[model samples]
Each structure stands twice: as structure tokens, then as C-alpha cells.
Target: MERSSAHRTPGDPVAGMALPVYIVCGGTGGHLAPGIATAQRLIRAGISVELVVSEKEVDSRLLESYPDLNYRRVKGAPFRLSPKGLFLFVLHNTRSFISGFQYLRKNPPAMILAFGGFISVSYVIAAWLLKVPIVLHEANRVVGRSIRFLSGMADTVFLPDGVSLAGIEARRIRRLGMPLREEVKHVSKETIRREMDIPHHAKVLVVVGGSQGAKALNDWVEETHKSLASDGIWIILVTGPGKNQMPELKVLQSDMGVDVEIRTFAFHRSLHELFSCADVVLSRAGAGTVAELVCCLAPSILVPFPYAADDHQLANAQDLERRGGCIVIDQKNSSNLYREVLDLIFNDWLLGRMRQNLRRLNHGDAAENLTKQLIESYYPGHLRATAVENSTEAKEAVNG
Candidate 1:
């Protein structure tokens, strides 16, 4: 359960009491949501918060809801596809990292928390050099290149349940559960279904391509949808707006089996309604999205983005399957042919078992778990007393 952030105000003793600040580095909602949840927890505990983000949507649009937050647009996230691309990505990332180091000279945090993305790499590096406590989080089963590159730099690295950190030092790692939306944790299913306009009599299937839409996934849904729609199944497909919305989809809607509906826009922060109305979810295996599924106890058919970094998404799905909360479908396999997913959705037993298993994987308090750890790490008497003290002095140096 999450404590509300509304308690923080300017003059009230309960809200105005001076508390040491914490810095979070992330931009994308995948990373930012966990950071935001953690920050809210710290704030309610009477700590101040600062967010250092890349100059991207991950920060501005996602973190816009919190006005008291101190925001800084750092470097852009990196994308590397080839040898030359990798070199340039590293060079730019290093420059961003140096900038993060300089920021520490003025406004050092008690400790730094990261959701493991390009934007966080610099923050971790800067924290390490300044000898401030640093914690890094990986929301997936398989750690990505960013986490791998900087894991050694952080004082501790936390993961969502079920990940295997094979080569990393055991002393530095711990398995914390996934952070979930506070709203989703307390949401009323009855109200959510009403908001989504989902019918009560129908078993709902939600197909999500991602924030930018997956053409291949949408194409597959288009091919087998009519038959499922003809049955009693409600097929709600989210094509992810902007680029994926098809003018031709009107024809698909026109030729409807009467049970299919499609949508294109949804707030990234408040996606609980879609999950609430869904009996089954079909989506790519991004760590953040899969964590939301487990948090909601929503069983899903996982299709890893075939081209995701290091093929990490596929590995994330495999871990969920090992935990029995999901079924993995590799896009490369012919067995994953178009109708296969629709068939799985129709398999009442398969869907029921996955939903039942998902309950076991629910960490409903991942944010709480991590926030508690942050409090321990940042407290003056904790194991990281030196880091906390040094960080305080660094910030004082900046304030002076």
C-alpha cells in the first residue's frame, strides 16, 4: 500500500520539516514510474526529491504531475545498432556522465536511485565518483546492457523477483519485487470496467502493440480477429496511436463481428483501467509492461520485440513463464503463427491457470520495498553512513 504524497506542503510542520534530498535519474515511463513511486514514498516519509532526466518525453510528460520536483534535462538516451553506432553511443553517454558528475558538486543527494536506462548511467557514475550511496534497479529478468555496464558502480543493485544475475557478485545483489502503479494497487475493478466501457458479459482480450504500436502484432490481430469477434469474445486492441492508427481499420471496424473495439490513446500513468477490464493481455515483453501485468494479476501472451536490445525482452518473458505467470511466444517460431495467440486466449483452462499463477508473482509493494531500502541506505546511522555524509557535504558545497 502507498502513502499519499499530498502531505508535503511549504509551511506545515509535518510537511515543511527539513529532510535530506534524494535524486532519481530516468526519463521513460518504464524507468520513471518506479522512480516516481519511490520518490513519492520518500517524500511522504519527509524527504525531499529531485529528478534528473534526459531531454526526452520520459521525463517531461511522465513527471509533469509532480510540480515540486526539481527537474534537469541531461543527455539523450543512446541507441546502438552497429560497431560504429556503439562507439558514438558510448562517447555521448560519457559526456552526459561527466555532466552528471559536475551536478553533484552543487546539489548532491543523500543517495541516488536509478531505474536503469541511458539517462541513469551518468547519475550512477557521478554518484560513484563522489562516493555517495547509489542503488540501481532492473525491472526485468535479464539485465540490459546499461545495467550490466554500471552494475559494479552502484553500492547495491535490486531486481524484480525471478531474475537470475548469473555473473554478478552475489554480495551486491538482491531480489526485490517489481514496482507497480499506486493507482492500480487500490483501483476498483467495477469502476475501471465502467470507465473503459467494457461489457460485463464478455470475456475481454486486450492486444497492446506498445506505446509506438507494433505493426506485426497488429497485423496478426487483424488477420484472426473477425473469427474471435464472431464468438463471444470481446477483442479490444490498442494500436498505440500516432503512427499505428490505420485509416483502413475503419473497414475492419465496419466488417466487425460486433464484439471487437479498438483504441489508440491511453495515459501511460493510468493504465490500470485497461488491465482491470482485460481477462487476458497480449503484449511485447518489456520489463515495465510485464511488471504491470504481474502487479494487476493479469495473465498475458508475451511476444518479445524481436529487435529489442540484446533480445532482452524475450529473456524477460522466459523468466515469467518459469514463474508460471505467462506464456512466451517467440516471433521467429512458426508455432507462434498468427492464430496461435488467439487460440490461446480462447483456451479457458490456459488463461485460468496463468491468471491463477500470476497471483504468486504479484509484488504489489515493490516501490515500498525499494523505498524502505532507500531509507535505510540514506539514514545517517545506516551501513552507508560515509556515502550519506559525503553526499551531504557535496550538496552543502553546491548550496554554499
Candidate 2:
């Protein structure tokens, strides 16, 4: 019952192939983090991992620690905006498609595991033509546009839950919660408070609006900093990129004498610490952020971005709201910020209720679950033994 290299077709790929190559992903941290977690699992189980990435936008340093990972550039892009933008985007996308095809034709992977993003789209098309088995992941509350277009082509499309994909035509979808790095599963609140130098008696509120700052939210917080700071609240605001008005906020903080903290960060990996320090998380509802908050059981005041594709952020926030886990505030209604923050923070009963509901949605071991699914779907035969072991582990995890 051993799988032979001669018979290593799409039906059976990962058996008897010495050092079968697993493609680790690198798109955004949202897409790439899950792939990294899975790659670490695969490597421990003795498989070779090759990282497919765009040499641009992603920090190669992020993948530097995993030297075992093979880094290869797949022509990737930022897509188009106007008519001229359309022409340029098409030109770049075509070149990417051609390069991806050539790469696959020369050096093939045992299986292609795609974590959906603009960069990963080229690989999906290449995998289709190469006859490689594919395992795709959709982490958002709604399947992304790229996943929707390629879902029919994948051997299996893995979802965070049914809430994320109700009308997509993909039938091979399985509900496996969003996989996260080892860090998300742990970090005591006291440890986080000590690291951030937060006072034990005050309520700690962490404000983040995706990787790039939410300017609207930041503006509102800046204007109302004194009033909130006077109410025994502490702020840890992550004002992204050039959006940090430190000179301005500092002046306001000094004049008002409010306990306000301003942080301007371009990149940060140790998010578990910040999440743990938080009593309430104020942020735009991105799928990746939502999963991490759920892991920490952080009560969220979700302000979904008004312009995300298919309004996916709104969908993400609404799904959590339905579970009674987080309160959804409209980004369009930043006028209500003061009222929303006050009502949630001062209301002890409301805070505890949210804590209980958010804790109910925590999927503590998503990384292991996702890795097992990819292996089972892509690997076959004597490896069916390993796959069976993986399935049993997944079932036990679900129950526990």
C-alpha cells in the first residue's frame, strides 16, 4: 500500500517522494501568517517548505527566521484604479501569469497551498495548468474576490466557517477556523500590562484600525482625547504610517493633561502582548484581527471599513455581533464615538457579557487544524495513514 513516484499523479502526490516540496505563502500577514504557522507544522513533521512570495511589499525579513523556507518571487501587483491604471495592471498581470507558468513548468511543487490574496492569484492559475493539487483558504467573513474566482478550480477550499462563505459555488469547502501563529494562543493579561506599563486600576483601551491607521477614527480620538482621558481610561493608539500626528496629539495631551499614549508603527509582530493588555479593542473588523481578538477573548468595538470589497469588514463585524461577542459601530457614524466608548467602558455588566460571548468563539488550535486538512487533501496512500492520524486529531480538537 505504498505510494510510488511513478503513480504520484493528482490523485496521489505526497507519498514516496523524498523531500516533497510544500509551498509556504507570503502575501499579507493575514494571508501569510496562517501559511507560516502551517509550514512550521509541516517542517516539524519532516516535509520541505518553499515560500512563494512577491519580493516587493512583504518584508523578506519576516521570512528570514525560517531559513528552511525557499523564497521565490512570483510576479505580483497592486492592481488598477483608472483607465490608464487598468492598462498597466493588465500588462503586469499578464507578465506575472507568464512567469508563474514558466516557473511551474520547470520546477513543480507536490501541492499548491494558496492563502488567498492578489499575489497568490497568479499561482492559482499556474497550479490549474500544471495539474497540481490545490488547497485554498478563505479567512474573511465573506470569501475574497480572488478566492471566489478560483474556488471552483481548487481541489478543496477551506473556510473559517459557513458564515464566511454562504453563496460561493465551492462545495469542497470545510469549516476550519482561522489559523494563527503560536503567539495568539497564549499571553496572560498581567504579563501584557507589565510589558506595556499599564496601571492595574485603569481600563486599558487599544485602538487599531488595520495595518494602515483609520484616519477618521484617529481624528475623532484626537479631538476628544481630554474628555475620555479624564474618565480614568488609558489609551494605546496605533496611528499607522504617516498618520501619526504626534506633535499635535502630544500638545493636546500636555495641555489637557490626559493620560494618552501615541504610537506610530510601520510593522509589529508581537500583537499578543497588546491584545492581552486591552480591556476593549477598538478597530476596523479585518478577518485576521478578528480571529486574534477571539483567541484573546477581547471585547471589541468593531468599526468596519466603509470601503472593503463586498463590504466584507461589515460582514465580519455583523457575524460577530450575531454571536453577541462584539458591538458594531458604523465607520460612517464616527459622530457617535464618544457615546459608544462611554456606554461600553462604564457598563460593567455589558463588558462581562461581551467577555463571556467572545470567549465562546475562541478556536484555540486553528493552525494545527488547517495544516491537517491541507495534508489530508493533498497527500495520499501510505500517507493515508498520516492523514488518518491528522483527521483524528482534528476531531478531538473540535470536541475539546
Candidate 3:
């Protein structure tokens, strides 16, 4: 891959003098978003970064917003034991390993910062072989397969509080929160409401089904939207790509003598706005989504994706619920979803408390703190001092 000057800021200390940090974050939005968030922080600190992502369409779509980010696409496939699954996994991973090795041999990175994903596996191994420092961040409470397999090779492993890997040394582990995109901020609800054309009096419910979308959640909305509409609720459903054949906005007169509006979209880019304006959100409890909800102070009813590896989503939801940030409903018991949403939406006191808890749970500077640690630990002498000073100033700015 050709080196691009686009990622370097005006005063980048090591703009053309040193190799850039390689961030292996792709496959799903959960992994990629946090990677981008950290990359942005590093760039602002005058550290160059190149993102390595999978060839998935979702990855491509999300990268559209970041036209200037230096990134490369690599083939990746999930690990499975079944015959065809294993065959494809080996085939794709081998290609990715070769691709990563060729590039890194020519232009070795200062370090490899990887968010757990299948796409990270190949590159992590290549970095390990090249003796490049590897830093792995696991957002979920239950560690992922990639992180678990690669943890021993990593110089440092970042994980959520109270979660631990059996054999990894305590010295190599750090308790760190998930990194959030800069766009995921707490904006004024009234301002967002006006921009989205939602009425001030409307009780807004936003449904998000992870990155590729949730079919079960979409079907639930389709089945019970009229009931919700009758209660004068405004619904914004993100149906995922190609999942919703008809995406339109509809305004209906509710039986309760109120105007109910429903908007359906295949995808929505401005999630921070959606979460900020929402009175309640129905979402899958992916670590990245949960982190965004906390940042936006959006109270939510979470349904963990039943098929998630090691049932990690359930672990994430449970942790949030333990902290009073959100409510968790098992997918098998989804028949209770409508009732739960209605009960929670109109409960102002409960919602307020949840928001407060979410605010307390919010670690707004995860990306900054993580970047600072990486700079202090892995960056070269002259560049490390400059980057550390810049990161400290940025942190002070945020706090000030």
C-alpha cells in the first residue's frame, strides 16, 4: 500500500520521519468505530495512523465519512469448526497474513493497536512475528476469540473493569473503557429535536440493531408500531441495509388524539443526534452501542444478541444493568418488549435516574487516555515527548 500524507496534521511531529501506528479495527462497527475514535485522537496529537479493515460492505460504508483516513482493505473470515467454515477461514486468513506481512516488512509500524475482530487476527500475528509492540483492546466483558488467542503476544491488553483473562499477567492488563467516536457526544435534546423535525412534546423511541441491523427488532417494530402510534409515540427505526424494502416517513393520527410520526431508514449516519433526541432507545447491547448510549446519556432497553460469541452481549448488558444504566430483556422473552418499552418511556423519574447513571458511567476520555498511554509507552524518544505534551494539552482542554 502507498503511504498517504492525508492523515498528517499541519504540525505533525513525525509526519514523514517515522512509521505510522497501524490500527487493526474492522469486520463490524463495534470494532471499527472505536478504532476510528482512537485514530482521530492520535492524529490530533500529531501521530500518524493507518487503519487496517476488512472488506465487508459495512466497513466500506462507515469509512465513507472519513475520506482522508489512511486505511487498507484486507480479506478476513470468521473462525468456525465446520468443514466449509474452517476451509474459508484458513483460506481468507492466509491471504490476509501474506498481505499484512508484505506491507509491514517494507514499512514496519511503530506499533499495532488492535480492537478485537476476525480481521485483527492475521495482522496481530504478523506484528508479533515482526516484533512490533501489540496492544489489544477488548470492549466486551467476555473477551473475544481474537483477543483471547492473541493476548499472550500483546505488550498490553486493555479490558473493562472486573473482567480478566485466566493466564494473562496482571501487569500486562489495564482497565480501560471503550473508545467512542468524536461525533457521539451529548448534544441538547431540544436542539436535536428541532433539527430532526420532531415535536417538542413527542416521546421519541429509536431502535438500533447493531451495525448490520437486527431483523427481530425490525419485525417487532413492524408488528406493534400501530399500538405504539396509538399511544402517541414517535418511532425512528433503522432497518439496516437491504432489510427494509420500503423506507419512508409517515404521520398518523393516534387514537389518543395526538400526531404520531414514524420514520424508517435503511441506515442513519447521525447516531449521536438520534440518541440525544430519543426519550428511549431499543437496541442490541453491543459494546460500542452501549458506549455511545452512555456518552449521549440515552436511556435504553437492551436486548442482547443471542448468537453473539460467548454470549458477550449478555455480559455487557448485565454489567450496564448492574450499574443502573439500562434494562436488559432476553431475546427469548421478547414478547415483553412492547410492555417494557411503554412502561419505561412514560416513567419520567426512572428515565431521569437512568440518564444520571449513564452520565456517571460515561468515560468520555477513553480514546484520549488510551492514546496518551500508547504514546508514552511505544512512541520513539523525540516523538513521544511531543505527542505526550500534545495529548496532555488536549486532555486539559476537554476538562477545562
Candidate 4:
């Protein structure tokens, strides 16, 4: 069998110079966060990086704080089965491919690392045409359509634990854990409680509804907050930054009276702190969220978005459930949501057991490990040595 493109011979430029890497992780925060975490690892190791993302409002809001990194944007739409939608998908993809090809031809990187999404399709195609090594990481428990279509062409495929990707050669897939931010690894529960000004003994519940709040989940939480708060459970709700008016949090606090601590924020940049302090989490089953929960050892009640691609979020949640890391609550029968939440909150033994299971499921040092593998797989040792040396000299010159 022919080796994947990643095993192809390296060019003199790639072998002798410090070449930048292009990471395509657009669409949602689930795709973007892992890409950013992996890119951060490469950057700290003296490699230059460029990020290609979709020109969506959510992307802009999530990426606005990372001014130190380079970024480029393209317009993308979800795949639709209708004729008009298909035509638009083709037209947008063709334009994206042409733009990507033009840019890479002018300023090519040594490789492209793609996190699955429609926006990444064009970037992967452009890199393949340029003969740059391509690596694909699919964070979903089930393979996404774009990645499934493009997998045969990738040099390597990386997955988070518990993904049973069939058809692809077992040799081609490696479980690299989830690419997570450095901060996700180091949050302290004590520090988080202090920062949020919570009493030391108070039990904390965190509600995560994705980048835009899940209206159903928020509504449920709103209706049940008074009872939960009265039981001495403090709620930290991340409603996301949407145009919708948030629940009257202050009024809710008044209704619950001083005994309950109910704090609401439209968004929080440091979600690790929130997760770190959580006794239990109520959240959607996005791959990034599950991975973060595992890292933080937070047991959760996962509500999968019923409309997600191929019902993949359901697959993610079920995998966690099977592993004893979480309990799955179907969106359709969410009438029992409060009961489930209360059960987890009140049952210390069950929560502790789930936490133990979650810890066993974590993939340690994911970003650092993946960075080392990418460098070793695609670049020769001398190239890394030269790159580091040149980077050191440049820094020294700037300082001097």
C-alpha cells in the first residue's frame, strides 16, 4: 500500500528552513479551541503559525482576544441536501479553494493541521495540491462528513478517546487525546471559589450552553433555580453572548433570597475556572466540552443537541455515559432534567464515582504530545534544530 502524503519526501526548503504551519479550525468554538491549543504548543516551540477560520460572528467573538496570533477568514455554510443549498456549498467551496491555493502558492507552510469543518475542506485541498503534509484531527466521537471524505488523503488521522472510526485503517488512526488549552490543565478549585467569592463549603453547579445559550436548557434552569439554590447549591450560569435578553438573574436572586448564590454572566473567557469549581455540570455534549470536563474531573449531565450533524453530539454523550463519566439526558424528554440535576447534586457518592471514572478517561498532555509527534513525523531533526537556533538568534537580536 502507498504511504500517505505525510510520508512523502520533504523539500529542501522544508528540510533547511523554519517553515510555518497553517491550522484550519473554523466554524465553531469546538473546532477552534483545540486548534488554538495545538497552535499555542507549536508557537512556543519556535514554530510560526497561521490560523484559517470562518468569517462568522461566533468565530470573531471567540477569537478576538488572541491578537498575538495570525488569522485569515473565509465564508462557509453548512452542507444542505437541497439543490439550491448544494449549489451554494459548491460555489463557496470553489471560491475558498481558489483563494487558499493562491495564498499557499505564494506563502506555503510545511504542513496543514485541520480540525474538521466545512471551512477546512478548501484548506486541506490546497495543501494537498501544494504537496505539503496534511494532518487531520476529528474531535467528534463519530467522523464528520468533510473529514470522512478527506481522510483517505490525509497523512494521519487523530481522534479523541472512545471514537470508533471504522473503514479507516487502524494503522492510520492514532488516539492523541483532545488538544486542550494549557490553562485547562492547571485550574485550582480553591482559587476559582475565591475569585468568584463563594463560601468555601458551598457546592457549585455550572451550566454551559455552548457559544450561544441553549434556550431550552436555560429555560429549565431558570424555572428550577430557586429550589436548587435553596438547597445550598450555588449556580454559575454561562448564557453565552446572544441578542436574547437573559433571565432576570437579579430578580431570581431576590426570589431565592440571601441563602442562594445565583450568578449569571453572558460569557466568561476562562471556562476552566468555572469547570474547576464545579461539583457537577449541566451542559451540551460538544466534543470540546466533554474533553474539558474529563480534564477537570467534573461529572456532568449531558444534553446532546438533537440536530447536530449525524446526531454526533448524542454519540459523544453516550460514549461518556458508557464510560461512567456522565449521564445522558435526551433533549426530547427533558421534563426530567431538574430531577436528574438534583439527583447528581445531592448524591455525593455518585458524583465522586463519576469523577473517578472521568479522571481515568483523561488524555494527559495532549497539546504537547501532538506537537512533538507532528514535528517528528513531518520534519527532519536537523530542521527542528535549525529552526530553534534561528528563532533564538532573532530573539537575541531584537533584545540586543
Candidate 5:
């Protein structure tokens, strides 16, 4: 079925094109990581992928390693508390929506995957106006305001199992587990430790402060450094950018008499590697962090950020804790973190049980499952051969 260039549309960058999936995910690693993982899976199944992302510093740094995918930026701003800030935010959002509409009109994809951010809201609206089929994913147990508003227009809303959004008008809802990088499943612990210069014998407690730095979490760790050191735990603290004083922390580590290795980084692109080297993760319960901890089978002490939208981080932590995978410490009562750490370290059986529970929460094939669903439900006739091949590959993966 050879086609001439004359039939090629201006909207498409490539000629003689089949339908590509357009993914709108940006701002933070939580949205971007899953989007990239899913895009990688789709590409492997011979599907084209184009991403619409924000040019936020974190987004740019994260996307640098993924050069094969096609991505463009749409300017975005968060809603502000002040009236003047609100006006500017609205103005920026309006321009973003217009930009998204123009891009979609030019390079219309087969469908859109909205990964729940304010930036994604604009693109989702543009896709709706263009009559493009859309699948929305809300990573948290409690839906984000943007995704809740756009749910009515989404063809399908994908959520984690047992999560429910009350009074959503989506055409259909499905439980498609969180998508994660392939490296999370395959990276060796020894290799990760060697790369980080952490000793294999040292019990590692990796502190992740999410994509944006958590000042409270960092302060807590610094305050409790001596206690943590007394327990013979080496800490790999990933201190995200903004108000970072890693040099001071290093100096403090050198002064301490306790035998604890406290290595700090502003940010590390390879977080999966850090997770692999961890015996216990002391982290803020972002949805992405929870998914990764579960995927890596790491025991954790989750402290949900109180100010997160709708207190969704708390819900995320609660869900994992309910399954006996981790202990949740309320940020307001964060003094409990030290006690929880002692309990985890002393109770060998507890740590192992939690790790076992965490392992049960892993969904390594989430991206593949989502890809299969999209092919079967929306474009059944379009990629029959590729779909069959993917099906066989999935079976072989499970059997092997």
C-alpha cells in the first residue's frame, strides 16, 4: 500500500503516516516518567509517539536522555494565590490552549493520552474540540482538578485499581496500573551501588524529596543524621534543586563521629538506580515514588506532603500502607519518622514482609497492557498484524 507524498497532510511531520499517539505529560517526573515509559512501549509495538511537554527545568533535564521520541513544549504556569498572578496564569493557559489547538490541527494524532497536569488540561481541551479520542490517567487515588474537569470528554479514564472518582462523566473507566521505566525491573543492586559509590555491605536508606525539593524532609534528615548514623545506615539523600545546601550537609557528615556515609545530590536522573541500592526508602509519597518503590520491592516509610493537591499524597500512602507495604507518617507528626525507622531496622521479619507486600504491588507490564487495550478497543482494524505480534511477545514474556 504505497502512497504518494501528495496525500500527506501538513499536520503530519512524516509522509505516508499511520496514526500516532499524542501524549501530554510535563512539569514533574511523576507525569513525565510514566508518559515516557508508555511511549517507549508503544514505539516498541511499532506505534508512533509524539509528546507535548513543558519546558520546565526538571522536564528538560529528564527528557535529555530520551532523544528518540518527538516532543514539543507548551508554556504553562500554575494558578497563583494573588489576583494579578491569577490573571497571568489564565492568560498563559489561554495561549497554551491556542498553541495546542494549532499543533493538533497540523499534526493530528490517532488519540491523545492526558497524564493529568494543568499543562495537560489545555491539550486535552484542544484534543476534545478536534474530536480526537482521548485516554486520561490520574496517577493518584484522588483525581487532580484538571483531570476531573476533563474526565467528561475523555473516552476512557485509567486509574489504579480500587481508586474511584466520584461523579466523573467519562465514557468508560478502567484500571491500568502505573507505568514505570524498564530499568526499574532489570537493574542490578550491586551495579547500582558501584555506580553510586555505595558499599554493598552498608544498609542503604535512600531519601527522595520528590522532583521538587522538600525543605521539611531535608531538614528532618539533617536533624536526625546522628541517630540514623548510630543505626549503621548509609544515606543517599536526593535533594532536588531549590534552596539546596549540599556543601553544608557534606561538612556536617565529615564532622560526625558516627560511621554513616551521607551522600547528597541536588538531583539524580537515574533514580531507579538509587532505589535498587536501597534497603528502605524514606520519601515523600508522590504517586510516582510510590509506584517505583512498589516496582523495586523496597520497604519504605512514606511521609505525605500535606500541601499536595487534595491531600492526594496521603491517599497514595494510605493505599500502600493498607496493603501492608509501608508505614505512613503524617508530615504534621513527622517526629514519628525516627521511631518508624527504628522499628523497621530492629524487626527483620517486618522489613521482609513489607518487601514481599511491595513486590505484590508491582505491575511490570502496565504499559504493555495499556497498549494492548488501545489497539483492541480503538484501532482494532488498523494494526491487526502488529497487535498479533505484540500479543505473542507478551505471552512469550510471561512464559519465559
Candidate 6:
């Protein structure tokens, strides 16, 4: 396969060619967030990126904040065995595959970086057929079905530390952590709390249910907020889109006549603020959410979405738990959630320890490292050689 013009230097003959890296990451925030993060890094390095996303509303909503990103929405459906489900899956995927193939044939990319999802299946196959190098990043502890299916065809598969896929060649796999967004870094707790008008001394509990709100977690907050508020815990609840109609802020009085505060939102664009301000977080254990928690050093009580495919959320939470970054509570035993939250929140020692562990787990350079690897894979030793040459030229020019 011919090398794409994307990696060429500006003075190269074909440098102005329009070939861009195509990132297939859609369906959920988990997939799309990392894709956007990596895309941002690539764009800063002078590599153009076009995101390939699904036709899901969530994808559109997520991309709304990223109007500058070039993206295409492809129709896709998850695989299902039922007759009707199977028919829709085949029909949608066939259309996606045809569209993807035609596009790639016309404007071949330097490479296709796919964050595993049903949306990626057709694109990966199309890229493979066109001999485009493919790279897969699996953020979860257990590999997803899409990555598992597409792994063999990929030039490289990036997995979290200590995680591996069964069938892929060991040489093809690399240990890299999740790529977090630029906005995911931590801010001072006091700074954010003051900005949000939260009390300085308030014990804050933040509940996040992922892109689509967790009804169980939402209900738990609804049932227990009053009691929690009575104990002087301020609540920041993200109820997902359209799941609740509560006003953004509410003030209540406890039996002891102490004023209590609760803030609720359908979705929050500034998650770093909430996570940084949180004393303890109650959240579903999606890999992206776990990575954000680690980035913010927010000690959390993770409730894995029991219905997650292949129980991947459980696996993700377990890995974090083993690393001492979090406490995992099975959704089935959520009755223990209130007690766990109370226990963790009041125990300053445990929370501090968990925060310390999370700091150790934070792979702050994951995006930069992944971007370097992706470029290196396409043009072996080219980046390093260019950097050395540039450095030498710069020094010579200065000395001369």
C-alpha cells in the first residue's frame, strides 16, 4: 500500500494532499471521548483527522461541543441473533460498509484508528480490504466483541496495562492507558467549589450515571438525598439527558434546621469541576468514566452496569479496585450503596489513600504517547530521525 500524504512534510511534493486519519469511534461517550482526545493531539501535530461516528443522537450531542471536528455519521446497529434484530443489523452494516469503502477508496487515510464499537465493524473491514493500516485501542480490562473480531486484521492493538486479548499476536499488542480529553485534568477543589458557589466546608457527593442515566442510581439518589442532605452532604447529580425534570439547584432544610444544597443537571459539559469538587463520587464504571475519575483523583464507589456487554464494566471496576483506586459495588447489591458512600465519605484516611492511588494510575501522557506510536507505526523511525535532524539544524543555525 502506498503511504498517505498525511505524514509528508510541508516541502514534500504531495504535501498538500487531503488525506486525513479516520477515527471510527461512536455509539457512546466512552468510545467517542478517547477518539476526540487522540484526534486533538493528532491535529496539533499537523495531522488532519476525520471522525467516523454512528447516527446515534448521543454522538451528535457529544459532537455539538466539538464543531471544529470533521466527522461523518454512518448508520449502524448492534448484532443481535433474533430474526428482526439480525435483519436490521445486516441491512444497516451493509450500507455502512458500502459507504465506508467508497469514501476510503476516494480519499485513503494515513491510517484508521478505531475505538471498538458496533460502528467500527464496517469501517475496519473496509480499511482492511483497502490495505489501510489499522490500530485498535481497548480501554476496558476485557476486550469488546468488536475489537476481538477486528483485532487480527489490525497492525496494532493498544490495551490497558496488564490486559490482553486471547487471539491477537503478542507482538502486535502494546500497553497504553486510556486517552483522556484536554478538559479532564484536575483543578483545585477549593477553586472549583468557589466558582460553583458550593460551600467551603460542605461534604460533596457527585453521582454520574454515564451517557444514558442509570435509573437505579438516579432512583437511589432520589430516595436518599434528603437523608444525605440532613447529614450535611451536598449532592451534585447528573441524571443524564431527559431522565429528570428537576431544576438545576435546590435548597432544603434538615430536621435540625440546617440548610442543605443539591444541584442537578441532565448533562454537564464541565465534568472536571464536579469531579474535582467531589469528596466522593457514585458512578457507573465505564472505562471512560473510570479514566476521568483517575485523572481528577476523585475517589469513587463504582457500580458497574450489570448489563454491560461481556460484563466489561465489572472487569474495569475490578481492575481499578485491585489497584486501590476505587471500591466496586455490584449493582445487584446496591442496597449497600448508601452505607458504602457514608463510610467512604467520612473516612478521610481511606479517601486520601484512594486519591493517592488514583494519582499513581493517571497516565497523563497517554494521548501524547499514543499519537507518537501511531505516527511511528506508519513511518518507522521517521519521527525520531526528523526530530534529531531538526534539532541539529536548529543548533547549527544558532551557532553559525
| TM-score (C-alpha) between model 4 and the true structure | 0.89
Candidate 4 yields a Cα-based lDDT of 0.81
lDDT of 3 by residue, 209-303 (tens): 98889999999998989899998899999888878844488887788788888899887777878999999999999999888899899999999
Inter-residue clash pairs, candidate 6: none
Identify the superior model by lDDT, candidate 1 or candidate 5.
5
Which regions of candidate 6 fall more than 4 Å away from where they truly are? 1-18, 379-400
Q: How should the candidates be ordered by TM-score, best one leading?
A: 6, 3, 4, 5, 2, 1
Per-residue lDDT tens digits for candidate 1, residues 56-114, read 65366666677776667776547677998888778877888888788775666666777
Q: Which tens-of-lDDT digit does each residue in 1-400 have in candidate 4?
A: 2344453455445533467888999888888888889989988877788999998776788787688889899977778899999988999989999999999889978788999999988888877877777889988888899888778767789987667666789887888777887667636778878887777677788998877667777777678788777666788888776723455354334233556667787776777778889888899998888888888888899999999999999999998999999999999989888888878888999988998898888756888998988877656664558788999999999999
**Clashes (N, CA, C under 3 Å) per candidate:** 2, 1, 0, 0, 2, 0
- Ranking 2 against 6 by lDDT, winner: 6
lDDT (C-alpha, whole model) for all candidates: 0.67, 0.71, 0.88, 0.81, 0.80, 0.87
The residue pairs found clashing in candidate 1 are 27-58, 106-398
Model 3: lDDT of residue 120: 91
Least well predicted 10-residue stretch by lDDT in candidate 6: 8-17
* Best model number under lDDT: 3
Candidate 3 Cα misplacement greater than 4 A, ranges: 1-17, 380-400
Deviation (Å) of 29 in candidate 3? 0.2
Poorly placed runs, candidate 5 (over 4 Å): 1-17, 168-171, 186-191, 248-259, 387-400
Angstrom error of the Cα, residue 248, model 4: value is: 7.5
Clashing pairs in 2: 381-384
Model 2, span 1-400: residue lDDT tens: 1122342355443433453554536556677777777777777665667767766543364565556666676656655688887786677668877887787778777777888777677777876776666677888888887887777666677876665454445566778777777656647777777776766656767788675567877787678766767765667677665677744233224334555554434445666667777788888888888888888878889999998888989999999999987899897787887888888877879888987888888755877876665555455443666678899999999999
Q: Which portions of model 4 show Cα errors greater than 4 Å?
A: 1-16, 162-167, 247-257, 382-400
Error of 2 at 335 (Å): 0.8
What's the residue-level lDDT of 290 in candidate 6? Answer: 89
lDDT of 6 by residue, 196-275 (tens): 88888878999999977788888998899988988888899999887875668889876678788888988877677799
